[model samples]
Target chain A: MCATCGCGDDAGTRVSDLDGTVHDILPAAAAPHEHPHPHPHEHPHDHGHPHDHEHDHGHPRPQSPGTADAGHSPAAEGRTLISLEENLLAKNDLLAARNRGWLEGRGIQAFNVMSSPGAGKTTLLVRTIRELAGELVIGVIEGDQETSLDADRIRSTGRPVIQINTGAGCHLDAGMLQRALGALDPVPGSTLFIENVGNLVCPALFDLGESARVVVISVTEGDDKPQKYPHMFLAADLVIINKADLLPYVEFDVERCVRQARLLNPGVDVLTLSATTGDGMDGWLEWIRKNPHPAAAAAGSAPRSGGLRV
Target chain B: MHELSITQSLVEAVLDRTGGRSVTGVNLRIGPLSGVLPDAMRFCFEVVSADTPLAGATLTIDESEGRARCRSCRDEFVLEDMFLLCPCGSADVEVVSGRELQVTSVEVA
Candidate 1:
């Protein structure tokens, strides 16, 4: 049995040398002296040493049946035994927590707005900000895969805005939103709107730590959109059927869309509105006003629900 | 398109679970209506796992059949793509399966 570490009789005990090479000591009787090789041309034994080192320490040299190098083999095996039970999305969740705290600290209610490419999310946001400009301090975070075009549109309204270009990423994760939040310079008692990238499927999977998730589905799209994309409807706290002014020209059924959405999500609030004509804007604002963030209300001991945000 | 990002997340999840251990194979279940394309996911996995422990891991995907129940006819039938109609030719149908994306298991040593 090797005396270096404790490959001897007392196997359970830990042995330490002056050189900081900690090893497990096994009882000598428990250590069997079996032949290292059961097959020909196979490496007989592998001493617990790295492969690159050449200086041979005066240890019992097992016969080299074959020349298969076992360098870095022990380290690779050691990694398998490690129990690193960590959530894969822990980092993203950490950033999301920070964002939640930041939003709560400033009494700001953040909403994640998601929709298809041609859906008028930006236009609706612009109109809402314009109408509620003096009554509410609003900030916008525009997310897109490439350009700052959405942010530019929001900037035209003279509101504080930050643009986050995801480059090739399909959705804005919590980490990206956290960075965008910092750039927006969020003030206390403000309404922050995060216009997610123009995609329906991917954005529904990611949680940006928003108080509410509003999914905008344009009436120009087929009436069966809610049924086709049920996950988006299921994740949405509110569903907005935009481009209502075009309903007369397009073959769109507003009631059918609302019914399909409700079938998927019983509690989802459905609002039909045209961003261009500002029709049905009051319903959207009323819904937001009723659902004031809990953390913000608890901080100031305000009423649980009402037109708290003006 | 979005499946590529999800594929990257799956690779990351496998790497995180196996630590630095060399994974020989990864088994995943991809349903028919999961909105994730198996070919696209395999392509993305090959690129994302290049430097990670799952670099050479073989990806095994199990495909599921889309099944739905017709609300009007009360008949169950296999769906083809986005057509949620029952075999009895009814448009009112509720999906019962074929929208799953999950990591079933992994082989490592």
Candidate 2:
């Protein structure tokens, strides 16, 4: 029988023999090019699970054109063709919404810090925390693929820090930050800084429910860094060009970097400073001071419980 | 590199939608511009689904064609590559396709 839409004479006779049910059916010419038929082949089953074993035995019959291949089924292919426009980042978006609500309720101003691997983000945080230790109570959540090294560094400065190891994940999504936030002791009048994993790509795509996003790029990494990673530049509310003290010794073009970054994000605040030497630390600290937690301040917030002073 | 994590999430999403029913297959419509690699997703699926209910579940990938529409000429055409332009030699175009990534459907038993 010709098997396009299952409307062939043979299909009709076969259906008539079974029952007098006339369901909507597609014609052979209208059928998609691919036929749905299960191909018998040996599939690997290395995991020792009973569920895996059962699935291995019963493979579903494939569907029509562009549907029945080795990987996907007919129903799935039809859904894909038909307008199943699901958001790719639905999970992240849901968590982000929840995180935003949680932060707003607490009246804490949270910001996500992003940078290249050696962009002096930790050093900047160390200096900022130390300088603002008396006025702004600060808490930090550090993200890394491996090692608690960054968290340990922040701990040495005697600040409240929580370390999240993403294992192989490239960025810190809102869900991961939510878990980390629970572990962190609440500081009523404090600013929360989430040090995202050292990646310029995926971190930009994720919203960690931060009030602002800061991107740190070192001058030594060259002026084209912003142009190369425009997504990160576009997403950042603040851009810090670190390692400014090394510009004299290294052949780095600061102007070009600033120009390109401005082209991508016209309103992005760019700050150049040397974290090691504290050359531009005051300007950085001033920016943080301007962002006051009005809701917490208005509530006559009490001092948080057991938070480290810088 | 992060494909394994994404695959694990994909498996969990399928299971969640199925309400604990056994999934026979999972279909994903990944656009060329989604920045996700099909081969990497396939490789990670096996490792991610190991010992889970979705283990051994087939993964089907569908590639979407890159298309754009010219704003100036009001002409629609397929983009030859990443350069968004109209077939009538107009660079003033807006991309309409080739940036989709979704868990289209799942076969549950």
Candidate 3:
């Protein structure tokens, strides 16, 4: 646990390029020897749901008299309501905006590819790299729980790749992507693919400031996945139904999936492809080509802030 | 769940603004579409706020309604869940409210 930042063992997360260069993602706030608390792990074994005791904080205080909720108000019991109005994801959003600024400055179209495990994200990426090898200068930031295997696969294709092993983390945040960018240093006018950790839920909540978000689902999974995990589908700018080769054997309903996705995001585009057999690959590639880097238009100008720097 | 990490961020944001003041209540605006469960956050808050300036701070979650505006008719309707279709038989809908995950205020001594 980091005493300075309150970040936990997950702070040990790092970015590794194909050249074996490794960079620790988190700030060196707390060293291992400085574990002052009894529990060294970030999540303690105590699963006591203190939700019932939320109001009973052992301090008795009356509510504010009025409904004016913006400023500080002295309550009847002498406590002050100091309005903060701060977004919970502000920190991540700031980092994501910085990442957007950097990516936009270089005319690099970065796509955040997210999906459940075994949904063939890496397979599709590998196939894309192979198919677009001559036309595109592609770079990848592969995120996994703790493995360089996917990065190795991307490296085998001869493109620059960086692996971010998120230790015990369910998803990749903007800070991790920023650190990976520093190591990868992808060239300008290239396509940067950020393969997020294989989790549909947590990754949707985080904004990595990518040009677009692509959620991949395989036919082996339930067709109702879009409805089951609406947040993931809602965040997706493009939904790719992968593993089309197994569509004949599986019970996945492509129409229902597309309908569910469209219900959440009417503007979302859906593509069905079998990465292994190269079926429906043209549409996928065309979509990538059509959706150019969002930041490319703002190139040569001052970095556009996401309302962070006024 | 991811609520733990979110709660940690909430604690940090609150403590950052408090300036060493002992916080008594932390008010938040959480919407259903925010992809955050208030119950899970409440449980995580108790765990993350331990030994900090926000220790024992009452987490008051204000759940916002999920509302959306139809692009065709401009009629604002209540969106209960992920089914984002508008009542005007149109699929194009713009999210007006909901999806709020903000730390509105803090009660301090």
Candidate 4:
């Protein structure tokens, strides 16, 4: 099934390249992607017990006090209460960790760009690629429920791009990236931008193993967006106020939006820019140039959780 | 909703941990800032867990309040909403709790 939202079958999730070559993301057990790293599969705990207990379901088990109607109890007759203490998103987190390690190991700086639909994420990326054509090497991974339209736009910039259609899935999970990395194979020392599906809520919840998260909001989207989507802002490392050229016509309070974003994320960087008009584009480029690659900082540090399995 | 996916993950994790044993109860700890609605999760659990080892299992969610600690004044306080600001006028605050989404325990037979 779809790893992120589980609405459709896994066969619906797919990755397509500019050449029109499509790759199906199979179920986890028979996933087509291969692991480059030879790290062993690990779980928090694996309690192996012999299946010697008899199957006894004849009578109704005695329920604990106060749980008879609720059918919930810490201990029940002929039942084993196992304390799992496991994170619900453990599988996604594990895949994300592997992606992070692989990217950091190659000194690749990947940014997860998220915004609502029509927030101009593709516009910003296309502009960035054209402006910094020779100065930087950039690649992109476009995410959407369907269609390769955004990927085609990035392809026009002549950057290596891959499009992931989530089908019924609302957001892209780490598993999708893990599969895309095999195709993109981003060069070392290059920049990778993952354009997440246009949703303010679910995208922030999944960590795609990006070095940093960038949230883009346009002037037409109202200044109270930060207040409305606190999780997205709080998880953002930088917030780009796009479509700044419409500031005069629209009633977007830039100062108030920045203040609210900072309130949610104290250290978040806010930049105002109009991708179409090229106003304030220099600041955005400068921020990208100044941003440190996680690989460089983690050169001498111990590997997270012992080692990463990619 | 995202809760559907989350509920699926919860059921899968419990089944994997319990080795596909018949489960009667699954306890979860959800924090307010985790971006998950407990009611939606409960509903999704009932839908996804059907016909699986967790069929008819009760999903007990323990919702926790958002808590944070101010880095400037070292004061800990509750976050009534999404704002991370502290009473001392310092926006530099660290979330100490309320982002939990874990399966604490499961009753399997």
Candidate 5:
């Protein structure tokens, strides 16, 4: 959805890096031309667990490739049946897994940082990038419903950053991030941080093809954020409790919030840090250094639980 | 909500799967934890699928309950929210089947 009404008016997603290189992923109105060859390929009955990625056409540019081949079958009177047991988000997820493999193969780690508005996501990113300074070549893809305000902040840090204006959209989908990755082509061995549009619900649903997903929450918000928006925490490998400096004045409970976050994701690493005072910054920096591909830390085996406080 | 974009992707998936056939309806199994609202999907599918192969397609939604298993006691139960506890009172539960958004089948004409 364009985050706008389907009025059939002018609509597009704009992606631009700091150097003013822009690319517009035009609306579906112009989508027909892109489907040059609709080769039919019947998908197997995978139902809900779609993990087959063997259909590699060696398609050069994968921001969002053309769609073709697939079908479904169902019981209906006076109607034919085409059985298709797959997830609607299968396309996006498949593209995301492809992007993940590309990044992992090159030893490049990407982080999808998400949170509600004013959670200090941008601020925390600025601090983290500066602290990592000479250590890591960081590239950022900032997403917002409208402005490039956060992109400006990241640019001020002198790191490579691209801004994706979703227009009416609520969160950044894999297609959006995949296109952004094309613009902000961080070199191999570099880390890319995709700062997703400020949202807890929708952002969690769309995997931005990141090596790890980080959900940032501030103490200014309610401590019950995890309980209210469990999916965000559940999908995240790291939960940064930002704005710790305000904890003395705010009624937010750190222990309670961490416990709640842990309940949702037993494997999640919680870091209570103040981006303002640089207190507890090392812990997060350490996490970035040690396990760039945090998903790798979780994906291979049964989930593990451990608490390492700094 | 991103339901609009989701609905768009969903329609494309259905149309692509149909392979140029005239589709009548779609059967979906959506979990409560899938983050998709059945009513919103039903409402948006009409608009997003307009002018596409899936136009006039009905989206039949089947909401499945969230199920989780406790690692401690190996007990399985229905999970409603994040604050789920096992019958044996263990909070360390691994969600086995809650977040699902799949197209079970499609009726073609």
Candidate 6:
């Protein structure tokens, strides 16, 4: 472990209500269902819930298993060389694999929604939930650095939502997604949306085991976003050009943006929509409804009540 | 941004195999597909690892470019990103390497 192995100085993420009470979404075995459950301050020191850093992170560690190949590789001078061939993101990938398997076993379709902050991701989400929540068992794992504002907005939609305050993290890694998934078990065969932290680059590199990655780029932000942040567009399965209602007022060249996105990711599909005025939302909803497993559709029919399951 | 987290892993890796010895330097092989920029890694390593045992260790990187194979013509070439065209007029290609993000070795006293 690095001497700086602690999670952080910020509070762990909390699931809160639209009002003021912060709720902890615990598993059924952890405790009986209670509404507006206050957090237990699990990591009092803000040592973030970084599952990957749980290993011997603080001290100069002893010779690890990774050093076993040291004797094979040539050592020069008096320095004792250790051969540790390990990926920098091995831990995250490992957790992501587990998440993928878990979601597959449960037949849940997870989508990673990514975009810059205020690209109308939440607004698009609210509109989607309003249209599709009645048909499918939808859940959201909202990510933000600080406030529970997004979570509150999602909660008002009457769906299971967990706000993961990343503190200082720019992107949501797989381990965090795993924890959030445990907190939000949105039934088998349901659609789980992981609204990634608002960023373009970092989130592209970290995989959260999502079935598909949808990127949102509103017209007002810039038509050159795809050219500037190519990695995000390259990693996206579907790219949405949001806030098209402001197209007349904004000087965003939609065709050029799509061309740039295509240059980065030739296989990605593009869609335009305006969440504010209910324009082009049907296509987005149809895209969400088009791909779920047939069995998940049957499972969505189960008895549903109390939008917030306490 | 995410480099801080990745740098932590690098330092953690170094300290883990250090065996309580003073680390002099580290050898890393970062592939193009690894999505890690060398500059960002160096900057973050300096900031986040200052308090760790690997504080003074020089990070030596062996950068590798991304390689891809054309799906249609089976031609091999260097890849910058997902978007590329083969000399054989084929835009269809699959990545062969450059996604590596590894710590190959650590030097300690």
- Fnat per model, in the order given? 0.05, 0.15, 0.59, 0.62, 0.61, 0.54
Per-candidate TM-scores read 0.67, 0.66, 0.85, 0.86, 0.82, 0.80
Candidate 6, residues A1-310, lDDT tens digits: the string is 1112113234444443324355433244542221212222234333244222233534344343335433244444555566677777766666666677778778888888999988988998888888885698888989887787888788899888988777667878776777677667768888888898888778887777677789999999999998788668867889999999999999999999998887666777899999999899888888887866534542321110100000
Range of the 10 consecutive residues with the lowest summed lDDT in candidate 6 chain A:
A301-310
Model 2 Cα lDDT, one tens digit per residue, B1-103: 5455456557656554443444667778876555457899899889877776677887888887768788889988886654454667666666687666677
> Over the stretch B1-109, how does candidate 1's per-residue lDDT look in tens digits?
6565566556666554544556666667677666567898889888877877788887877777889898888988886765455778666677787765666555555
Please list the C-alpha lDDT of all candidates, in the order they appear: 0.66, 0.65, 0.77, 0.78, 0.72, 0.71
Model 1 lDDT at residue A255: 90
What are the DockQ scores of the candidates, in order? 0.13, 0.14, 0.44, 0.53, 0.50, 0.40
Q: Rank candidates by TM-score, best first.
A: 4, 3, 5, 6, 1, 2
Q: Model 1: how far is B90 from its true place, Å?
A: 18
Cα lDDT for residue A288, candidate 4: 92
The TM-score, computed over Cα atoms with residue i paired to residue i, of candidate 6 is 0.80
DockQ of 3: 0.44
Docking class of 2: incorrect
Which 10-residue span in candidate 2 chain B carries the lowest summed lDDT? B13-22
Candidate 5 wrong stretches, greater than 4 Å: A1-9, A26-76, A293-310
lDDT of 4 by residue, A1-310 (tens): 5444232465477887546476665355543433322112243333476444332434234334334333235466666666666777777777877888989988898888999999999999999999999988999999998889999999988899999988777888888887777678889989999999999988888877888789999999999999999988978888999999999999999999999998888778999999999999999999999887766677422221201110
Q: What lDDT score is found at residue A15 in candidate 1?
A: 24
Candidate 4, which CAPRI tier? medium
- For model 6, the docking class works out as acceptable
Off by over 4 Å in 4: A4-11, A26-73, A299-310
lDDT by residue (tens digit), candidate 1, A1-310: 2111112233222322222232343233443222112112233334466332232334323223222222212213322221222322334445555667778787888888999998999999999998887888898988776666777788888887877656556777675676556546778888989999899887775666677789999988989998887767767789999989999999999899987887666567899999899899999988878768645474422211100100
How big a share of the true inter-chain contacts is recovered in candidate 6? 0.54
lDDT (10s digit) by residue, model 5, range A2-111: 32222122456788866756556634453221222232345554536534334333322111212222323334454554456667676566656656766766667888
The prediction achieving the highest DockQ against the true structure is 4
Q: Write model 6 residue lDDT over B1-109, tens digit each, in one string.
A: 7777788767766665553455777788887666678989888878866756577787888887878898898889998664655678676676677767888888765
